[model samples]
Every structure is written in C-alpha cells, then in structure tokens.
Target: MLDRLAHSRGLPQVIRTDYGKEFCGRAMVVWAHVRGVQLRLIQPGKPSQNVYVESFNSRLRDEYLNEHWFPTLLNARTEIERWRREYNEDRPKKAIGGMTRAAYA
Candidate 1:
C-alpha cells in the first residue's frame, strides 16, 4: 500500500486514522515520518472523534465482506481493490456536499 500511496497521482498531505496497535507501532510512525506524510491518529477508545473512518470501515464491511467471503488473503485484496475504486470514484459522500469523494478530490 505504501508503494501505491507513493505513486498516487497527487500526494496527500494528511491522513487520519484510529491509533490501533499496528499503526501506533514505531515502525509505522517512522515510516510516515520518513515519507513526509502526516499521520493523524485519533485517541484510542474515542471513535466518534474519527467518525468518518469508522463509518467507512463499517460500510466497507457491510458492502463487501458481508456479501463475499474470501478464501485467502489474495482474494480479499482483490475484493478490497475493487471496492476501493467504487468507494472513491462512484460513492457519494456527505462530507463532500453529496458529491462523490472522487469528484470532491
């Protein structure tokens, strides 16, 4: 994913997420720092403060995982890639004033 992000059309300035142990680890922190990407991690146990991502996660699970069970990590990755494109380019978002996130972006 880091490779994907680095090669993204336009580099993003800030990325916000929940401070799970995986992201809170020194490795991730250092990686973000080295890449000059700002990582905005919400306080643990305060999910409402990160409502957008939380809701996104819920919707992602509902829209994809609940419908199809992957047999392996590779299948899951493929499913995720498919959904991510639709989510960004097609799905309308309230935060973007009802425009698709891709349109807003």
Candidate 2:
C-alpha cells in the first residue's frame, strides 16, 4: 500500500507512526532506509503525540467506516478511497476557512 502511494505521490521525507509491529518490523525499516525516509515513532500508548492522525482516524470511524458494511476487501478499499477523495478534495473545512483540503493546500 505504501509502495503504491509512493509511486503515485512520491515519497515523504518522514513518516510518523506508532510502534506497531507492521511499522517497526525489519521489512518496513529496510523500505524506509532504502527510500531515505525517516520513521518517527511516537511514544508507546501516546496517541496524543500523533494528534493529526488520531483526529483523522476518529473522523473516518465516525463519518465513514461506521456507516458502511463491505462485502469484500476490494469493495471496502474502493469505498474508502472514494470517501477519502471526497473528504480531502471536495468537503469544505471550517478550520481551513471553509475550503477543501486540496484547495487549501
């Protein structure tokens, strides 16, 4: 998934994540090292350290995930991607002066 995103949008300088096994494992470490991307791990049990991601996750759960049931993994991916696009590109955010995230960017 990260590979696909990197191919489409280019690599980020750093990735901030929790100390999950998926992110902390050797393969992920190697991948980031090869790409010159820094992996910044938040403190254990400290979701507040990653406020932006936590907020996004909360909104995703409340506004999208909780409202839909997927019959398949692909369906879930597709629907989530659709919602993600709308959330980032179409939905206006008052915090950003009532502009969509893409437009604000």
Candidate 3:
C-alpha cells in the first residue's frame, strides 16, 4: 500500500511507520534500502508520531467499513476493492486542501 501511494505520487524520499512486524520485517527493510526510501520507525508505545495514519483509519472505517457488511471474505475483498477506488478517486479529504484523494494526487 505504501509502494502504491509512493508510485502514484512519485517516489518519496522517506516514509514513517510503526515497528510492527509488517513494517519491520527484513524484507520490508531490504526493499526500502534498495529503493533508497528512508524508513523512519516510531518508537514503540509512542503513537503521536503516527497520528496521520491513525486518524485516517477512523475515516476509512467510518466511510467504508461501517457502511458495509459482508457474508464472506471474498465478498468483503471485492467490496473493499471497489470502495477503495471510489474513496481514492472521489472522497474529499482535508489533508489535501479538501480535494478528493486522487484529485489531490
């Protein structure tokens, strides 16, 4: 997902994320190093540094997850894929001057 975001906007010089396994795994570090994309890790138990994504999670949940229910994993995946598209393309965001995510991109 970070790669997708970076590619869409152009290669970012750096990225900040938590110390969770997904972000701290060897593979992820290797990939970031190879790409010259600095990975800034927030200290464990300190969340204020990652407030951007933490805040976005609330919005994502409210606008997408809260609006739908799924009977199966496949169904959920499909709906999420479609919802993500619309959210990225049409949903307005305050972070980007109140423009849709794609528009801001």
Best by TM-score: 2
Cα miss at 50, model 3 (Å)? Answer: 1.3
What TM-score does candidate 3 reach? 0.63
Off by over 4 Å in 3: 1-6, 71-78, 81-105
Model 3: per-residue Cα lDDT over 14-75, one tens digit each: 88998889999998899899889999999899888899787767777998899888999999
**TM-scores for every predicted model:** 0.71, 0.87, 0.63
Candidate 1 C-alpha error for residue 36, in Å: 2.3
lDDT string for model 2 (23-64, tens) is 999999999999999999999989999998998899999999
Candidate 1 to truth, TM: 0.71
Q: By summed lDDT, which 10 consecutive residues of candidate 2 come out lowest?
A: 96-105
Q: Rank the candidates by lDDT, best first.
A: 2, 3, 1
Q: Tell me the deviation in Å of residue 1 in model 3.
A: 5.0
* Model 1, runs deviating above 4 Å: 92-105
Model 3 misses residue 32 by how many Å? Answer: 0.4
Give the per-residue Cα lDDT of candidate 2 at 12: 100
Task: Give the lDDT of residue 34 in candidate 3.
Answer: 86
Q: Which candidate order results from sorting by TM-score in descending order?
A: 2, 1, 3
